[model samples]
Each structure stands twice: as structure tokens, then as C-alpha cells.
Target: MNCTSLQELGVDSNGIGGKIPPIIGNLSSTNLSKLYLNDNEITGTIPHAIGNLPSLTDLCLDNNMLEGPIPLEIFQPGWLTQLVLANNQINGEIPKSIGLAQHLSIMDISYNGLQGTIPETLSNLTKLGYLVLDHNQLSGTIPPGLSCSMILDLSYNKLTGQIPDGVAGLSSLQIYLNLSNNLLEGPIPLEFGNMDKIQALDLSANKLSAAIPAQIKGCAEVEYVNLSRNFLQGALPSSIGALPTSLHVLDVSFNRLTGMIPQSLQASPVLQFANFSYNNFTGEVSSEGAFANLTDDSFLGNPDLCGSILGLAPCSGKHGHFLYIAIIVVVAIAAGLLAMVCVVDHDLMKTRLRLTAPSIQLSHFPTVQGNATGKKESDEHPRISYRQLVDATDGFSEVNLIGKGGYGHVYRGVLHGGTVIAIKVLHQDHAGEVIAGSFERECRVLRSIRHRNLIRVITTCSTPDFKAVVLPFMPNGSLDSLIHGPPCGGKPEGPRQLDLDLLLGIASNVAEGMAYLHHHAPVKVVHCDLKPSNVLLDGDMTAIVSDFGISKLVITGARDPEVGEASTSVCNSITRLLQGSVGYIAPEYGLGGRPSTQGDVYSFGVMLLEMISGKRPTDVISEEGHGLHDWAKKRCLQHDVDAVAERWLPRDPPSVLPFGPPRCEMEVIVVMVMELLELGVACSQLVPSMRPTMDDMAHEIACLRDGTWRKYRATGLKAIDQTKSKKY
Candidate 1:
């Protein structure tokens, strides 16, 4: 190839793997303007010879596996316009000469192991607009003369000292300014109030102290603020409560703030997530506006704060104290009178008590059954009547049905109040007693458990002939639809519409939900019916675990008394007399081992594998025999991800071209796929004891979601080094 004539070499976003050949640098094309070999699995040190391309204007070797210090020689190109080497393992300090590239406008070297103080010469890049140095080991105080036209992120670093006052003059700063998770201490710079257009500001997890300046309200466009986990003292400025209407999140927990929470904050309509926990605030906790929907979890650790919120004491007044004393006197007087009357007419009183006791005892049965239904209802989730639900679902029309399960049909409903909801109606049958019992059990479990990844039970309706569970409407439908692309009915076609990050995110969410059920919730729940269809997706594509129809409550050292006779019937119904749904049941569960957390883990593993490989477990038509786990285990042994990747990736040459959407490194994808398959194999072990806990599975999936699997692998490699270096 005549290399001198080449102006560009684009091999980005393909399934290319392995190290970038050093010989490519031999091109030395004087006319080369762009080197687009990014988003591939190319490893090893970037060839220093590529610096010889004097005309190269853009270098895009990002999101790859290349390591080692960036070649200082690359900075020789004065005409370089953009340099994106982010999300790689490249170490060593950024070259001081980087500022020599006068035309450079973007430099992102984030999420790497780069160390040493950020070079002060960076301030010379007048045209630099985006400078990201987050999630690295960089130390030293933040540089002072950074260009105003940049989105500066020095978060998750060891930077110390106060923020530079010069930063306040940067009128061009508009996007984000994050200096969180650092060792920085001192008062927040008053100049920060000058960034009128800044959208997000996160200065949390620092040693910074002093009251938040009232001047910060000047940031008119700021939408998110997180100043939590600091030593900041004094009451939160009242102005903070009145921040611009654009603000959505304000978290200032773990501080030394005192006094009543600003009532203005309670009135803020746009604020969604606010935390004031672990503060010295005292006063009546208002249940108006934002506080109306907030639970006690948001205001815990403040003993002096009383309110109408559940789990909090109601405010008491002088008159209330007098009323309590008067009630006590009246009760004492009535008891004495009753005792004298009983003594005078013992036989007559005994006969009257016998008649009344039976009626009272009969009423206690319904009270016990109601208690079995779950915690008391709150205004946030008021009990909806069967009639209201019927009207909301248009008299249970089939056209409104969104899904179906053994419990009943899930129909999309719009109430008279204009609230969209998902109403899950239960089937009334000869097993009326069993259905009612299951409904109570479901209510018990759902009411007691609350997490971001767990489905929220809005309200429930029960009648002699019908029962239903109401939940918030999930617009994105189910993870099953997003994973398998749905079965006809005018759903969008082609790819499953899930990218690598999104798929891992979904898996992580499901794992998180399972982990919470297994270990963190008020009661240990085993989601006996865990499958793709049971996982719903919200508008933000977040996966929430749903359908706890057959979930079992596990109590340590004893069986749950609440789960009594009803659970036995539920277990039979859910396990399909023994085994769960084909392709998703644990091996031991089929042998009458009973529902446990390990069973849920095994089901998650199978669903995870099925998601990666487009084959259903029931369709076990592979040469490996058994099901998806067996086939994936065979593929894992062969160390070939392509066997399963073929089911998801486009095979046509045109579709695989460089200009296509960015893809995760096929090599990284293979590693992730292999690890996931190994997870399946581990969870599906014949002996239940050999399987990993749902907690472990959840952690692993979280690691994969955040791109930390490689770091953990690197740490494991170091452990090997430590073992080998030890004396024999």
C-alpha cells in the first residue's frame, strides 16, 4: 500500500481484537489527518512511531485495552485538534507538552490508572473545551489557570487545598463541575456562585466545612446538587431551599446542619430526591409538598424531628399533655366502677361475657387475616376498591391487557384522577381460599420491602369474588420484550435494541433486586418465579423485579409463621408441582429441595445466559444437550464468544463498517460473556452448597456494569504475583 497518499485509516467500532500491529506506524503518511482505530480490543503500548504523522489532526484510540505511558512524541503534531484516550488502562502522567498542540479542543483521559500531579502546562490550552481527569490516581491541588471554556472534572482524586478562586471567573463553564470523593478541605469557594449556567455540581465526600454560601442560589440553571458527606456545619441556607426551579436533586446528608428543614424545600415541586438524614435538625416535620410522599427513611437519625410520617412520633402540645392525664383519670375511675358491678352480679356478668366473647373472638379472626394482608395502609398507597379498579380498566377489557401470569392478567389502567397504573387482577376459582391467602402473602411481602429495583405496589383491591394488585405503570414494559424483541404485535423489529452497557445494567438491576430480597429486606424472600417476563422495565430502562406471586418468606432458624399453610400451596403452584419453568429452574429444586435464595440465583444465571445467547432453555436443540447452561458451558470451554455473539451481532459487512454506532470491545465482550457463562455454570451446580449466593452474583454483575471487572481481574493477577514472590 502507498501509505503516503492515505489521509485517513478508519477501523473503529468493528469486532476487531488483539494488539494494534506496530507496523501500522510504518505508514508515516504525511497527509494522514485522522487515526480512527478506537472502540476495538487492540492491546499493548501505543506505537510511538505514529507520532511521525506530522499532518495527523485527530487521534481516537479510546475505550481500548492499550496500556503504558502515552508516547510524548505524539504531542509533536501542532495541528492535532482532538485527542481522546479515555477509558483505557494507560498510566503515567499526561505529557507536559500536550499544551503545544495549539488547535487541540478536546482531551479526555478519564477512567485510567494515570498518576502524578496534573501538569500546570494544561492551562495553556486556550481552546480546550472538555478536560476530564476523573477516576484516576492524580494528586496535587487542581491547576489554577484552567481554561474557562471547559467542563472540569477532577472528581475521585486526591486533590487537596481549596478550589482556585480563578475558577469563579470562568463564565464559559456550563456543563458540570465535579470535585467529589477527594481529600480537599476548606470552605466552598464563594466564586462558584458565578457559574450561572452550570447544570450539575457534586462536591460530596470531602472534608470541606462551613455553611453552604447563600450566594450559590445564583446558579440559575443548576439542576443537581450533592454536597453530602462533608463536615459542613450550620443550618442549610434558606436560599438553598429556594434554588432555581430547574433543580431536581439536593442531597446534604451526613452534615452538622441544625434547625428545621426549610419549608421552602418541602414546597419545591421539581425536587425528586432530597436527603437530610443524620443532621441536628429539630422541629415538627411538615408533611406538606415534597415531605408528603417521603418516607421516614429520608429523615431518620434526627430524634428531635416529629411528624405525621409513619414511624415518627406525632407532635405534642401542652393541651395534649393535659388530655392524656384526663384520659388516665377517667380510665381508672371506670375500672373501679366496673369491678364493683362485677362483684355484685358475678353470675349475670359471667353469662353476659360468655355471649359477647364469642362475637369478639370471631371478629379477631378477620383482624388477624387483615394483619396477614400486610402493614397498615398510608395515604401514599391508599386502598383502592374493586369498583374503582373496574372503572380504571374499562370493565376489564382485553384490549387493555399488558401481560398475563398464573396469578391473573395485568391490564394498563387510567384512573379518573388521570393516574396511569398497572392493575394485576387475580383469577377467582375453586381455590378461592388459596387465592385470598396468596394475595395476603403478596401484600405482606411487597409492603415490607422497598428498593429502587423492586416493584412498588401502589394499592390493592379485594372482594369476595375478585382480588387485584395495583402498581405504577412501567412504560417500557418488560425486560423480556427488550431482550427478545417481543413476539410480533407491531413491536419495533431488527436488533433487540439493547447495547452492552444497557444489558449489563439490566442484569445488575435484577441482581440488586434479588440481593435485597435475599439479604437486606425486612424478610428474606425467595423469588420462586424469577424469569425474563417477571422483570419489568421503567421509563429510564431500569429493571425492577415484579410478580412475587410464589415468593417464599424465609426466616432464620425457623419457618415463617406468616407463610403457614398458604405457602405450601403457593410452592406447589409456582414450582409447577416440582420444577420451575423449563430452562430457568435450579436442579435441586426439581428434586423437592424447596425454594431458596440459591434457586433464585440459578434462575437469574439462566435468564442472564439466555439473554446473551438468543436460545430459549426449552429449545435445548444444541449438540451439547441439556439447556442454555450446558450449551454455554461448552462454548465457555471452547473459549469462543462468537458462538453466542452471532445471535446478537450483525453479520453483513456493511453493518460492520467503521461508521456504525460505537460497540464495546469484542474482546471485552467475550471476557464478560465468558464470566457470565461461568456465573451460570457456578449457580447451576448440582449441589446447592456449591452455588454462589445471590449477594455474590449481585456484586459480580455490579462490577461488570461499572466496567470494574477488568480492575478486579488485574487485582487477581497481582495476587498471583504476591504468591509467586513468596519464599518456599
Candidate 2:
């Protein structure tokens, strides 16, 4: 019989359902270069002989029920470049023969039962760019020679040893380099500073030691660098000041460093997130430049270090009164000159400007209402008066206060027409000359946005000294209050116990609100701060996202500046100046200060995780070890997630249990909780790109809810059918 060519077969989403054909290996003479068998219910083991096709360059067997180890014969040729065998029940070690395929660039073996050491030979592929070996039992040292330039994730494994020195030579590395939650040891290689284009570097929760190498200052393009929970020692490098303005995140907590912080390091405007806590550093902490904004928490647990940060003891010793005197003398001299100039030149300046200026017609302020001709008479736009807002907010009384946040306080008020509203008043400190422009930008953006999930910007008031926004009131309060506050008091049971269904419902709504802001709104708005507190719920429990004070409107068609190449350090500095609260801010924002859609996704992911875990993102448990994400992931892999969920949400059956079986209700709750936990795990993935988009997350939650409801309904129908058959 003539052997059929594999090319003769076309299996691209043809709805072909069933197991892999036993005779698949017979097509040995096929000239096929691509084989896609995704989106099918194909089952059983992959045939060993199936790898005989020498011309195969792209093989996608994902979204299938395929099982067994990757065929060793598949790695024989150098033609293969893309191998996606993910989302399968595949097991066994990756064959070392994979290294022979020198052209392979993208290999994903995630979400499998794979085990054993990573094949060192696989590192020889210099062209490799994306290598994912996550969520496996892979063990042993990472190959030193593997130098993929893009992303190299070896998380959620039993991998050990120091990061190989060859990794430092991946000069094309841009997005991230994560080797967290591993058994890596020894000092971080000084050679890593040579990766000039590295964007984010995470070596947290490892056993690495020694002072952070001064050589790191040479990584001019690096934005985020985390050395947390290491045994590092010695004072920070003064040369850290030489870092390019792109640097944003610098964490060296849980170390043994000492001595005064380098003043130069503190002066860099690009440094937004810095945590030198739990160290042995000594001497008076300086607050000259960017450091002036940092509080004791940034440098906490270092008893010997003193500063002016609130809650910390003030610095003692010498008081410099002469410097204060000199500043007063200079100000007095300038004031005297200003008074003389005002008296002598006031009339001269006005007459000179009128003579030199062009004559123009003046327009009066426009009326608030339109005329019969459908044209406004004045040029001014409608502006809410400050007094009107004050009256609406009951003279800014404390009783009206609903919530307080980093930017300002939110108040619940009722207008004269009985329209309930939320009023936000700027904090006194941030209400300065420098913030006036930002206030205007926010007003302009909020007024233009009119989405259901987004908090409606009814009106705003802006004066030289005061700025505030009026919004529709949310009577049910914020999600934060419900999750973290004391139980509601009116009912016999103190606070209404939060069931899994209710929690998932609220999470779905929050995701929907975030999705609208990220993709559906007229302008792409990044709600820079996305946490429980920012999500408000109305009487019907519909979630509405609030707080746009620091939100950014991403202009369509505008290209983000190249990561490593920008005109001025000022741009990077300006970006870093806007980093929001600690727990919710994306890591990238604290690294290079570059903002992207991924940043908002990361924040959303954190919130999703928080909702499921019923724990604050910054809660002490999270800070002690891996975050809630890591905790949930570990439990999920072990199939013990139900026990973990029960810790946060009790499963006590209702006393007046309905007519339905109690066991059935318990099972429904268990399944719902598990689904929510899985969603949380996906959202808080260590890799920002791996996290689901808000739109996808919302859809997934909706499916979970709908799926559960359908199952419940079907069970009821089945019971009725069984009773009818019994009667017959």
C-alpha cells in the first residue's frame, strides 16, 4: 500500500472528537510543517511514532485530553521552532534530546505532570526566547548555558542552585526574569548587571546572600530589582545613583545592610518604590530629595536609623538655626524688591502691554441654560460652584464621610433635590500649586466618561485653593468595608454571613467594571488603583469603581516610548512620581516607571485574589511568606483547595435548612468556592501577561455562576423525572 502523506490530513478545529488514531504514525512521508489539533476532546497517549515527521516545525496539541510523556523522537530534528503541548495530562521528563533542535524558540510544557531535572542540553538552543517550565515537579539546577533573551519562567518548581552566570549575557531580555520560590543559593552574580536591557528581575524568597553588588548600578536599563528575603549584607552602593532614570523598584528587605543610605540614591527622582526594611542599617536617615516623601515603613525595623517620618523619633544632636536664618534673610530681601517693583511698574506694564497687544472682542460668561436659538450666549462652560458642593456635602461634615483613601476622602451627601451623591475633597497636603494641573486633567477626563460601571462624574468644582468632584452615591458602601470591617449589626446574626455565591457575585461585578474601564470605554482608562476600597456597591449590590484622582487616560494611537530609549530622564522621573499605594500598584510601575495595560491587569488580579481569599493584599500573612496567590496555587496543585477555602468561609449549615438536601447545598458551595479560588490563582499569576484580562475574568466568573445555577436546576428536574417514573 502507498503510504499517505501527513500533509493530506487537515485537522484544524474540524470538530474531530475522539482519541488519537493508532495509525497516526503510518504517515511517515508527509511534507507537513504545521499540525494543529487544538480545541478537541482527543484522548489517550500520543503515539511515539507520530514524531517521525521530519518536516514538522509547528505542533499545537493543546486544549485536548491527551496524556503521556512527550515523545523522545520529536526532538531529533532541528526544524522544530514552536512546540505547544500545554494543558494536557502529559507526564515524564523532557528528553535531553530537545537541545539538538537548535532552532526551537518557543516551548511551553506548563500545566502538566512532568517531573525530573530540566534537560541541560535544552539550553544550547541560542534562539530560544520563551521557555515556560512552570507548574511542574521539575527539579535540579537550571542549565547555566540557557540564555533565552525574552522570558524564562522556572517558578512553581523544585529547582535549586544559583542562577547560572550565562543568564547575564541575555542582553535582549526586556520583559521579566522570574526565579522566585525556589531553593537557589549563593550570592546574586555580579555578572547579572551585564543584562543591560532587563526590565524586571525577581529573585525573591531565595537563599541568596551578600551585599547587593555595586556592579548592579551598571544595569542602566533595569527598572525593577527585587532582592527581598535574602541574606544580603553591607550598605547600599553609592554608585546606585549612576543608574539611569528608568529605575523604579529597589527592594532589599530582610537583609543585614548597615551604614547611612547614600544621599545620591535618595536624590534620584526615578526611585518610587524602595524598601530597605528589616535590615541592620544605622545612622540618621536622610530625607533630602525623593526620600522626603518616604515614611518609616520604607525603612522600618532599623532601630538605629532616625528620621522625620511620621511615627518615627526625630533626629537628635545638632540643630542648624543658621540655615533657617539665612533662608529668612533671602526671602525678606526678595519681598522688599517685589513691593518696590509692584509700586513703580504696575501702570507702566499695563500701558506697554495694551499698546503692543492686538485689539479683540471680549465675550461674557455663557449662561447655564440654552436659548430659543439653541445656542449658549456666553463662552464659559458649566462649572459647579464650591458652595454648592459644600452644601451638598453638609458643610463637609464628618458625618458625611464614607471613606478615606490615599488621594482624598469620599463623602455621602444628599442634594436639595434629594439626589444622593458622593463628594471627594482633596487632602490639604496634595492641594498645592503643583497638583492644580492634575486636578484639571482628572476633571476633564471624568466629565467625558459616561459608563455604567465607572463612577459617573456629575460635576466638579475647581478654585485656586479647593478642588472636588461630585458623584452618585453608593448606599451599600465599598467592598472593603464588607470584607474587612465589623459585621453589620441589625440582624440577629451580627453581620450577614458572606456565602461563596455572594462573594463570587460581587467579584464578577468588580471584574465587569474593570473590564469596561480597560477596553470598552471611549478612552482607555487605567484605574491606577484597583482594590476593595475603590470598588463601591449600590443598594442593589452593583459594584461601581470610584477614585479617578490618579487615573490615566491612555490616548488612542499614541505609541509608548521604547523601553530603553527615551529623550529625557525627566519623562521617567515624571512617571515614577505617580506610583500609587503599595499593595495594589503593579511591579512595573515601581520598576522603570513605564505604564502599560498589563499594569492595570496586575492590580485587578490582586483584587480578585483578595476577594477570594477574604484577606487583605497587605495582610501580615501575605507578607510573611509567599502572597495569597502562591498559597492558593500550592494548595490547588495538591488538590487541597477546599480545605483552604473553608478557613476563610465557614460551612455551617443553616439552622432552618430549606427542604433541599443539606449535602447538596454544601457541595454547591464547595464547588463555587473552588471556582472562585481558581479564578483568583489565575489573576495573581507572577507573570503579568499570564494573568487574564478583566474581560476574560468577568466572563469566566459569569460562566461559573451560570454553570452552577444550571446544575442546580438540572438536579431538581432529575428528581421530578425519577418520581414520575416511580409512580408509573
Q: Which candidate is the best by lDDT?
A: 1
lDDT of 2 at 118: 89
**After best superposition, candidate 2 residue 135: deviation in angstroms?**
34
Instruction: Mark the 10 consecutive residues where model 2 has the least summed lDDT.
Output: 358-367
TM-score for candidate 1, residues paired by index: 0.46
Question: Against the true structure, what is each candidate's TM-score?
Answer: 0.46, 0.46
Error of 2 at 616 (Å): 1.5
Count of clashing residue pairs in every prediction: 0, 3
lDDT of 1 by residue, 1-728 (tens): 46668887776644356887766667746788878776555789888877777887778787677899988888888788767787679999888988788777666677789889888888888776556677789888878887735356777878888778776556667556778898888888888778886766888899999988888887876777889899998888888777747676788889888988888888887676688889888888877787777787888778778877765556887675466557758979999999898688877867777786521111121121121134453334565677888888899898998776545678999887787889988777554665666777677778678888998877677666778888888888787777766653357423337765567788889988898999999778888878887888887888899988777886677654356654686676554422113357765453335878888888888888877775666444212224565567655447666666544443434322321222443555566777777887777654455578888988888777566544634544555455557833
lDDT per residue (tens digit) for residues 1-728 in model 2: 15445453435333345787756555656676666675455778777766767777767676566788888887765587767676678889999888878877767676578889988898688777657676678889988877775567676678888878887556666556778667888888888778886767878778887777888876777777788887877878887767747677778888788887787778787676788899888777676676777887888778777766654445664353345446658979999999999877877877877897622111222223332123453544334577877887778898987665434567877766666778777654422533443454456456446656767665566565677766677777777777666333322211344445567677777778778778887667666666777787777777788776556666578543321222133233234232213346565543334555567777777776676666765442213323455556665535776665565433553332321244575466567767777777677544454568889988998898678745764665566566658878
The reply for model 2, stretches above 4 Å from the true place, is 1-383, 428-431, 486-497, 558-580, 620-624, 636-639, 647-660, 713-728
How many backbone clashes are present in model 2? 3
All-Cα superposition RMSD per candidate: 25.4, 26.6
Query: For model 2, which pairs clash?
Result: 223-591, 249-590, 366-378
